[model samples]
Target: MKHLRELTSLPTTGLYAAIGTFDGVHTGHQQLIQAMVNQAQKTSTECAVITFFPIPAIVIRNIQTPITLTSPEEKAALFEKLGLNYTITLQFTKEMAQLTPTEFIDLLVSNLPIKQIWVGEDFTFGHQRRGNTTVLSQLGMQYGFETIIVKHFLQNSEKISSSQIRNWLTSGDLESANKALGRPYSITGVVKHGDQRGSKIGFPTANLAVWEGKLLPASGVYATFAQVEGKIYTSVTNIGFRPTFVDNEPNAQVECYIHNFDRNIYDLPVQLFLVSRIRAEKRFESISALIQQIKNDAAKSEEILKHAEFQTGLLTGSTKTAP
Candidate 1:
């Protein structure tokens, strides 16, 4: 997908666009995006997407601890997979937020030959949030374009939303979050250095620097896998500061011990797909007790990950006991 970093004056021809943050691109979002692509195809125009970064909430409310469902890079990869022709990530600024509904629509119509526009039922924009489907259609007619509003996609009688997904993840309901997302939620980043504490415990780990602003699941041990060079390996990951060692820290850490594998993987890229939460992290009485519990955690991880793999058909790495 052509990533348009320049927000202003986008050179375009025959573009049909969808506009939203599309953070997780849940099932509802997938339907909206696919409809946009289909409309673009019917009109013989390019399928494009536009979103604002730093999130409207963070920019407007100044949320102290802002968490994102998808990192910018992750969102790009997903949109590309969904067969979009281009994605324009505009930096959210105070000035842009001040545009009136008509002004924003005029901006889009002027910049690109927008043949059609797609959005979800709850989608709205412009100053004081005055934009809606009705206003959008009126503007579309004035600009000689079409507007499409997709129905809210639902699962189990409830609307699937990114906020709902975040609640599920925060509550450690990986299955529910995955159900709404139509795929396992994952985090991708480069492996970074950590205190060599895991080495002394005989269960070395790959410390990962998670994507900034990406929301992490609840603080616990998780049954997961690591993807490196297209090969998958069974992994047990911890997603909290070592409560057994550290106390009252502001930052949380993510690190995973790859079972049955030994290699220097620091500084390499890896994607960790969290399959299931194993247990909440706890402080042990002694180092010996902690070591023993880790061994049990490894066994439990393999079992849970194998079951999840069979159910989801993803990351079926070695499930047997690691030598």
Candidate 2:
């Protein structure tokens, strides 16, 4: 996909576009983008996806949310995978956030050939979210472009949303969240050198420090899968400060000890797919105690992943897949 970082960089006028933060690009977001693609194909116009960098919420509210399912790079990659003609990512700023509904539309229509716009039914924009489907519909008529609003997608009668996915993740409900996301929710990070404590304990782990601003699941031990060197493996992951080893560190961490596997993976990028929660993180009284618990956790993780299968409308179908 051609990534246009600025509106002035747009090379053509007739574009069909959809706009959103698209943080997770979950099932609902995919539906919206698919609708945009279908519209573009019907109109024979260039299909573009417009999203903002530094998500409006983070830029405006100064909140450091956790790492998302898809980073900006991953989002663009997914757009390319979906065959979008272009991907436009803008840097959110105070000035841009102040634009009125009409002004925002004018900024795009005046710079490009915008023949159609697609967004979710609950989409909002402009100063203080003053713009909505009503405003876009009115402007579409005035600008001679078509506007389409996709109704909210649902699963189990609940709206499939980014927030809901985040909640499921935070609660370690990976199976439920994956059902809503159409795939396993994963976090990618570089494998770092750890304390080697796991090696001493017979469970050598790959320490993963995720990219900044990535959301992490709740602090606990979980059944997970790790992808390293293009190969996937079953694993157990711990996300939290290692209270058993130390008590003063404030930041939590993610460490995965792959089961039935052993190889050097330091500095390699790995993606961890959480499958199920096994237990809460706790402080063990001794190293031997902790090691024994880890053994149990690892065994349970294997069984959980062996039977783990996501259902609902999101997944393509049901199959017993490890993680």
* Top candidate (TM-score): 1
Question: How many backbone collisions does model 1 have?
Answer: 0
TM-score of 2: 0.89
- Model 2: CA > 4 A from native: 8-13, 65-69, 308-323
Compared with the true structure, model 1 gives a TM-score of 0.92
Q: What is the C-alpha RMSD of each candidate to the true structure, in Å?
A: 2.9, 3.0
Please give the distance, in angstroms, between residue 214's alpha carbon in candidate 2 and its true position after superposition: 0.3
Cα misplacement distance, residue 145 of candidate 1 (Å): 0.9
lDDT for each residue of candidate 1 in 112-208, tens digit (9 for 90 to 100): 7788889898889898789988999999899998888899999999999999999999888988998888877887778898899999889999999
